[model samples]
Target: MNIREGKKEYLDMQIPEELHQRMNDVIKLDRKRRNERKVICMIKRTMASAAACLVIFAAGLNTSAAFAETAAGLPVIGGLARVLTVRSYHASEGDINLDMEVPAIENTSGDAAFTEAVNQEIEKIVNDYTAQAEQEFTAYKEAFFATGGTEEEWNGRQMDILVDYEVKYQKDPVLSLELTAAKGWVAASEERHYYNLDVASGRELTLSDVLGDDWKNIANEEIDRQIKERIAADPSASFFGYGDNELTEAKFTSVSEDTEFYLNAEGDVVIVFPKYEIAPGYMGILEFTIQD
Candidate 1:
């Protein structure tokens, strides 16, 4: 896909109507499965990104299978070009169900050692989440039975955990990956992990890599200003401790190189705060775009 002026042109060509319809069907199927399983939250952003890749590949298949396969094998701009589901886990009992998609990287172009390091990191993250989910589910099951809840009742209580990843930015030399893990019953809790890499050197990029030495001061100031502006503009806008509290001060003033962030489609730096990290769970995931 060719991205021009912040818009993806999908190779600057038209996709056939039949292929477009098939892509739509795939998206619809994904939604249906999510609904049927009653997963807490949907990773819409990552799903959309995945859908686009599928569409692009599907369009290529229409021309020639060989060409399509070649294009699919092409390396992404910076390093990792292909994101595929390496593993999936699913379990459904009376009231509980768990589903997860583990993403893996392929066709990486970089120093062999560095590329392996990045891949290993991705695998470790996914495995950690999978382990946690399994542990939680097992505990829940034990507790349900101990509380006199019948097996049928246990089967009826529904919970879901999903994992997905998106290519946030893929410009030359810099590549950003956004990994999402979302879970919930009535409401969902979501967390995002960002990996920014300098492909040439096989080094992970921190906030300081993108911003300069004064990054802390600049980022904290911008975040504080935006937070105050949001609260002023809308009374409903709320954070954990906004007024006069050390907690609020600590949260707002502690911007560091390790802060979680990624470049959006518009190439804006976006700072992410997991649910309840800075505000109520109802606020979902909190994000602020650092103005350039």
Candidate 2:
């Protein structure tokens, strides 16, 4: 097809605005992370280059990285992991804002059970959070009126409600994904959940698998060492117990067996902590890379 025909067809296609924006985000992300590589229109297959993948697969993509990349690039599919936005719901009602995306994985390396479980959990999370958000907003508005707050004072006020997911790591059959639900109306309520899967085995990736049987001790020692080093290097550098902190109980402790984490491009295990989990909220989310 010529450029004009392609342009006309694109114009004629019916695409949801939210889906379009999401696809744009994916493209931009790909462009940033990936160096110059021949991005072709045709579908192709590429093997996992890392040694870890060999151990896992020869020992997941039951969908390979090449297939995922090619499929994601296509205008219709539009995201990583062949993770299509099966549900995109948005609302702009006054002071009651809602934005959500429910993704469905296609041709996953994980078995049918794994895929089904992931999808059900994600859908439930999104649905439950959305319902809670709406309730919270309604309750807040009622309380405001009862407390003598005028309509004019609350007329222009608004709060965001969002439920979304992102694939943090997707190498062949091993995928690290996260789901997040947040509201800004009051108390900054936000919750995040992570899924690190060995898609081939249909089993969740554990710290033990990533860092061996002594994963907890290794992670704790390395984290504390890193924190102390940072504090020693710069006094101003603040981490909960290492530096200035108001919350005495929020100190960096040994990583839990089910701690949220992901694999970096180099196949290194990067531990993740949500905001205010181990430090103040100003520090936002924190990550620690387990050194070899």
Candidate 3:
């Protein structure tokens, strides 16, 4: 027999249907791999071209090697339109300068990337604003409290306001207050329980107490009412009261205790510490006040 012709050989090697399908899938995978390689190569080429352009631009503008490296390394930081100029000067010699532009950091989907970027920007803005506010608060402290300064003193008393919002905390809210004075000192911080309410509502509530009781775990059915009564009845004052040989002058007074619940609106509660007992050598008074 003569050697098989081209068509005969092709027909003889023809695969079964399932095998043919499998082969087709393999071919598709190979094609996909090749396409992926091509795209990667294109990206590499684009990045290299961009890096070269950036290097040239930087060199023409007298920017440094470090800046060029930064621009090349951080593609995200490199792609931004606005250039930030960083300069450093030494006492002995030459100054160093850098120009940086941020890149568009993107995620898998375009929308997600945009949203994440906007959120990051907002976070930055909030952080900057908070930092500025903290600086102002510090300056206020220094100007008012530093002795030998005649700046019109800012009430110079500690006023603690529970910041409700307009500021996002990175952590749990920290409770603190600062009272700065040029000549005075904070002796002792104290608190007392009292009551306040309006008549028309007939709904009554206890006023501010510095260390309010946590009645959540109580097993008693009337625990809340009992707490209100206990707090109301001059409750034996359990917190650092009446130390030996201290002059006492202040008293606890109530403002309002009404069960008019309002969201973020001021609640009816105010407790005032009028007279504070002073220990020997302690000239300033100790008082605590709550307002809502």
| lDDT per residue (tens digit) for residues 147-231 in model 1 | 8989777555566666666565555434455566655553333445566654434456577755668878778888888888888
How many residue pairs clash in all the candidates, one count each? 7, 1, 12
TM-score, every prediction: 0.65, 0.67, 0.17
Error of 3 at 76 (Å): 34
Whole-model lDDT per candidate: 0.59, 0.62, 0.28
lDDT of 2: 0.62
- Residues 197-285 of candidate 2: C-alpha lDDT, one tens digit per residue: 54434556688877899998999999899878877896766788766665667788889976777666566777888777787665656
Which residue ranges in model 3 land beyond 4 Å of their true spot? Answer: 1-110, 147-292
lDDT of 3 at 134: 43
User: Can you give the lDDT of residue 72 in candidate 2?
Assistant: 42
Q: lDDT tens string, model 3, 60-97?
A: 33556654454454323232221121222212111111
**Model 1 lDDT, residue 266, Cα:** 63
> What TM-score does candidate 1 reach?
0.65
Candidate 1 has an lDDT of 0.59
Please say which candidate is ahead in lDDT: 1 or 3: 1
